[model samples]
Target: MTGLRYVYAVCRPFDAPLQAQLTGVADDPPRLLPHGDLVAVVSHVPEADFSEEALRAHLENLDWLTATARAHQQVVDALTVVTTPLPLRLATVFRDDSGVRQMLEEREAAFRRTLDRLNGRVEWGVKVFVETERTEQAGSEPAQPAPKPASGRDYLRQRRRQSRTNEDLWSRAEEFASGLHTALAGRADDARLHAPQNPRLSGAAGRNVLNAAYLVSRDTSEEFVEMVDRTKDDAPGIRVELTGPWAAYSFAGDETGRGEADEERHGESGGESGEEKTGEES
Candidate 1:
């Protein structure tokens, strides 16, 4: 009750309850802080850890950042299950409940609009990866290495073939991903494209071609999932992934309410693709 408020999301009143033992960032239980008809889902965290200065330092520590992001995500995920929440960016903190209330009052109109737009809808994430070399392989066997070049001319010829093959595979991957995105977008209320994740960071195999989030209605979720399933085997060496029924994280934005300083500080948190601010800090 005494520490800085780590806000996870904003929502309209709902009868559904959060888990009895739900622990949010800083291992504190989240409580609803209502202002007017809106509610701010928040948890108290130590100022020593959540202060702007402390956060700037902690953001540099991957282990700390990961833990925090995971905790923040837990609260947002929980909210998704009970109501349509307009998630705040990761690590959003305010000095006190008063500050949180001020934010709510300032953003009330935008919040209401976004929440209405997102009600009865959820977010779906899809990613496509292409392992170019895998396309050249036959079955599960490793590709046989080319015989040692008999001459410089032979080596050059082999190089050309390899180059052409690589080009063709990449081209096909691009085409397939583009086509798939178009199809999914058609079925979604809204769509957002994100930068391909770094392999080192995501630890995902193959080269990423598409990273997208779609806003989908709950009623048609099964059909949307089926559409994604049907594309799993559509391309030989491409990998497709789907994740969702998530809170409409991608579409939650209140540009009019976001001050320049806040925008500079939080940038694009809590919206679209659920990207974390783990890379660089402003």
Candidate 2:
């Protein structure tokens, strides 16, 4: 038999049935690749050849990645909706069922403990974007004739002024984001700051000020959304986009051999929420 690759996550057994009902990456039936008390949730990769080039190609295509991720997320969310699921990172793969079982056996205790901590909770993603303040006044500004530069000193002064303006804008943006983070922290179980989005892709003159994620209990989702909505209203200059109730993707770090150790030490903090906000680079 040709072996298939799989992605493993530590979740409650009750979630398996719900996860099966949800759609997954491929049309192939999803299965619970189980080992003892732990289960390795899996979907088969039907590709005949699992070469490095094939993996690279799949990873490079954003569309493929997003679709697969969304599909995988659907299944994961179904599980998370019922259980505290520790989501695996995108493109995590195992050579076969045996590999998954061996991993589960090796890290069984850690996985169980992680699941215990995450039970009855879900992840939420939030992003803040600041639209550039219009420097030019609207409807009244008239075009002025360019003034002739008398000396190189004048040109240098112009460059310096522009640079200073840019720096100040960025500094203000950071301060605003920091305040937002501080405010949201009170309402979240854990929080994380992600790198800001690029201005070009964000299409906002100001900047992508904040990228963040929060983990909250299922019962607290409403309160969390309310907090984010309030933050948006308070900060008119910045637009906040929220997404998810997704699996804890950003929180799940490298899970190779150290899977057990990692989970045991996986201290929860503020993490970037799983919001699918698009920027220059994902």
Candidate 3:
């Protein structure tokens, strides 16, 4: 029989029991696959139901995905409460237990190192959205401009002017992002700048200038949040949003063995580029 695959996470040995209590759908038990000191929280899926079309359907439905993800996260958080756990990428899967075992064997050292670095720490996300500048309305009567420039030189000058304006805006935004990152870095175990996303969807009244996540020790979570709050209060024209005290989802690299190398890589370079929420889609 072809068994279904479910990818969960790798955590310390002591975390397994608490994770089991909070995991899976309804009363269904989560499969705790252990390897040495590391444990993978998984569950069996039906092969026929996990085909390409089915997988696509599953991913496309936000409600289903969100519920499943929340359930999965509950377990990861439970584990985190007891021990440091590395969260795998969303939707990581394997054909069976053997596949998971092989992956653990292949990347054993890297996983160990990642765990070592992340031990006793958790991840938090903070996003800053810059309010869009309100455009000034021209007076009621259409303002007549000077005679149209007949020379190409004038047109080139106008183009250059616009280009400079665009460059200036981006430069200022980058500067702001950098400063915010620096401010928070002092209070965090690690800080990463994430790529910005669309303003409309990210619940921002204006443009999103900074999207970032920080990994901080559990004991320091409150202090880190306070620092972020202070930065938001001090900065004008920007609104910051914070989520997490969550499992180190953003910091968790590729614990799954399905060649998710690029997608699951973490640390300073692995986060979202801007307004995009890392690991939100999958």
- Reference-based lDDT, each prediction: 0.78, 0.59, 0.62
In TM-score terms, candidate 2 sits at 0.70
Q: What would the per-residue lDDT of candidate 3 be over residues 184-227, giving only the tens digit for each residue?
A: 87778887665675544433466667777798998888888887
Q: Write the per-residue lDDT of candidate 2 for residues 1-282, one digit (tens) a residue.
A: 243554635655663256345646664445677677777777766554223445556555556655665666566666666666676654455667776777678878888777776666666777766554532222356535336667999878866765775566557657877887787777777786666655553344556677777767788889888877776655434567777776665555444221211211222211221222111110
lDDT at 282, model 1: 20
lDDT score, candidate 1: 0.78
Poorly placed runs, candidate 3 (over 4 Å): 1-3, 19-21, 25-27, 60-64, 133-176, 256-282
TM-score of 3: 0.68
In terms of lDDT, model 2 sits at 0.59
lDDT of 2 at 22: 61
RMSD of each: 5.4, 8.2, 7.9
Worst 10 residues of 1 by lDDT: 256-265
By TM-score, is 2 or 3 better?
Answer: 2
Question: Among all windows of ten consecutive residues in candidate 3, which has the lowest summed lDDT?
Answer: 273-282
Task: By TM-score, rank the candidates, best first.
Answer: 1, 2, 3
Candidate 3, backbone clash total: 11
Ranking by lDDT: 1, 3, 2
